[model samples]
Target: GNLPIKKVLIANNGMAATKSILSMRQWAYMELGDENAIKFVAMATAEDLKANAEFVRLADTFVEVPAGKNLNNYANVDVITRVAQEQGVDAVWPGWGHASENPKLPNTLKEMGIKFIGPPGPVMSVLGDKIAANILAQTAGVSSIPWSGSYGGPDDGPLQAELNDEGTIPDDIFEKATCRSVEEAVEAAKNIGYDNGIMIKASEGGGGKGIRFVDNEEDLKNAYIQVQNEVIGSPIFLMQLCKNARHIEVQIVGDEHGNAVALNGRDCSTQRRFQKIFEEGPPVIVPPETFQKMERAAQRLTQSIGYVGAGTVEYLFNADTGNYFFLELNPRLQVEHPVTEGVTGTNLPSTQLQVAMGIPLYNIPTIRKLYGKEDIYGTDPIDFLVDEYVPIDCHVIAARITAENPDEG
Candidate 1:
């Protein structure tokens, strides 16, 4: 990225974004050594902070992160700001969509004159809420699913999407996106207009945590009750179930100068119970034409909104007609960034920081012309090139790559 840096702070602790923090720290050190370049700090529970003694040691400082029992987030912006003020950090990178409306974080950090190393809070809020995301997708004309507000609660209001009541879900939906009122839910079921089956999602949540398929009215009714009970504390959600669908997503970036381009699209169909255990880029299906069309739609959304930074737009592929619908938008770096990195040869975090700091992308001529299918995926390609094997969503993977650190070496 060639981004000149002096200081950085990370606002979450998840193994998923472990590489982003460590790599940035190491890469910065290598580029600028320990003096004028930078240092890193991670905020999370004191217990979690203690667990990674070695990793914490690499950080210039460590701040005790406070969270509720669920660990739903590690966002105590007050504490983070104090540390940033004390340490004089130039930026705070919310790792992997970590601060999803922790409310106090963004405004506090902005007030302190420290940069939030992600997109604007408005963009994040627009994409974080599932229903809002669905609306954004429709407005952008992107392919994904339509989702109504949270469903399933005794005293709750009405629901607008479909519902099911046949009773047997392959798994269950109460776990993540909760539910709405039964009457509202029942009415929603009648409105669905599909014969095969319908989906019940937790409207107030995600992380692929709460979602289920109710094959019939009986299932939908039972699911409504179950989800309503489950989300008594947080709201449960519901949506238009896209069955036998191929889940796909594209990592998009826009700049202050009005440029929105896709890094690449990933096929997340190999998920079991909605948790994506495997993924690969340059979609297995969706010929070049379809891919480009999707990208154009996605870029239009980001461009229209003047979106900047690393964001992901998710879509659903309908097997019935091979059409994609807007599922939602992830207005932050995703877990699958490595797939895009392997293809684009670009540092997304650097791009995001630059853009957020009022830097334009036009100077980088390769912004949109990055990585064609010929450069990576294709038959009869480069004879001297090594073949690559990316995991398709299917099995248990507990693997690690071990290598000597170049700096140490």
Candidate 2:
């Protein structure tokens, strides 16, 4: 175990990597006067160099790689290791995309004796598997959607199917099953009650990659096989598609020592076709107690898995009934983590580095400030513990989307 990380590599590209670089710069400025205290190296692709010229200049050093090479690729592993060894980088941080959730990269890095600034590979594997994530959530006492389905692993079985469309089932969210074949799935969809419609999801897909929606039995029959064809390497299952559910998630930080905390929550309800369009923290509408319950559940889930780093536990909230179900657990830095940072005044990126260096959860200064000492709760400014019952005194929102030029097409 390293005591404190010195040189670190920003092993990913895009805005997430840029944000991490900026966050690290800010943290270095405020905490450590020495600009070289924690050196940062970036893996720059041709596109990154073109798009993020500013970051290229800001990095302590960078190794140029080919364009379109994903961070999770094995080839990148050798590249990263060579650069790390050459530059004396003690750890690697995969911001939020590409290799962030890919367990293989972390496992490989660990074998090379380099710290991966996120959760362990086994933890990622469990959370990466949709069905395993569901079972973990339930074991952690979190309420998850009523689901049924099994992962057939490498060997495709009766339950196995493919997925299509733009939506993905976060490899960890299991599916419900009443039948096996397309005819059986259609019949089962009818028996399951499609008042809210039926949802077809891949057992091991995410990012809206393997999902299909059908409003009636006829639609279900027609789309069943086609939906399964969309996904590869996993089984698809059915579920009661929630028509009007608010997507809320709790931001969690955990350390190697088994302690964890829920910073706050975000409402990413403003989404289009399963992609989040906007997100805001301390959602304006949710009551206080309900929010507390979510925080508790999120902490419980992360701690249960010995999660180390910044991760998010998503939920489906029904405003009418005030009920929520655990949706999925994203075991890496989320794109919307800044929303939680804005509300909680937490330096998540820096904290993530500290955790990777073996810092315990409670010992983190921000955690102690937010969750005060046991003896002193409110009056102590230094040890001020954030009251779970009271929401943070700030609100933050984010909006970023991609669009095409119609005229060009």
Best candidate (score: TM-score): 2
How many pairs of residues collide in each model?
39, 22
Q: Best-fitting candidate, measured by lDDT?
A: 2
Candidate lDDT scores, in order, read 0.59, 0.72
After aligning candidate 2 to the native by TM-score, how far in Å is the CA of 207 from where it should be?
A: 3.4
Total clashes in model 2, counting residue pairs 3 or more apart in sequence or in different chains = 22
166-283 per-residue lDDT for model 1 (tens digits): 2111123322223346666666665553364667666555654455677677788888766655544444445667677788888788776676667667777776545676677767
Question: lDDT, candidate 2, residue 302?
Answer: 84
Where is model 2 more than 4 Å wrong at Cα?
50-52, 69-82, 149-180, 187-191, 372-391, 405-409
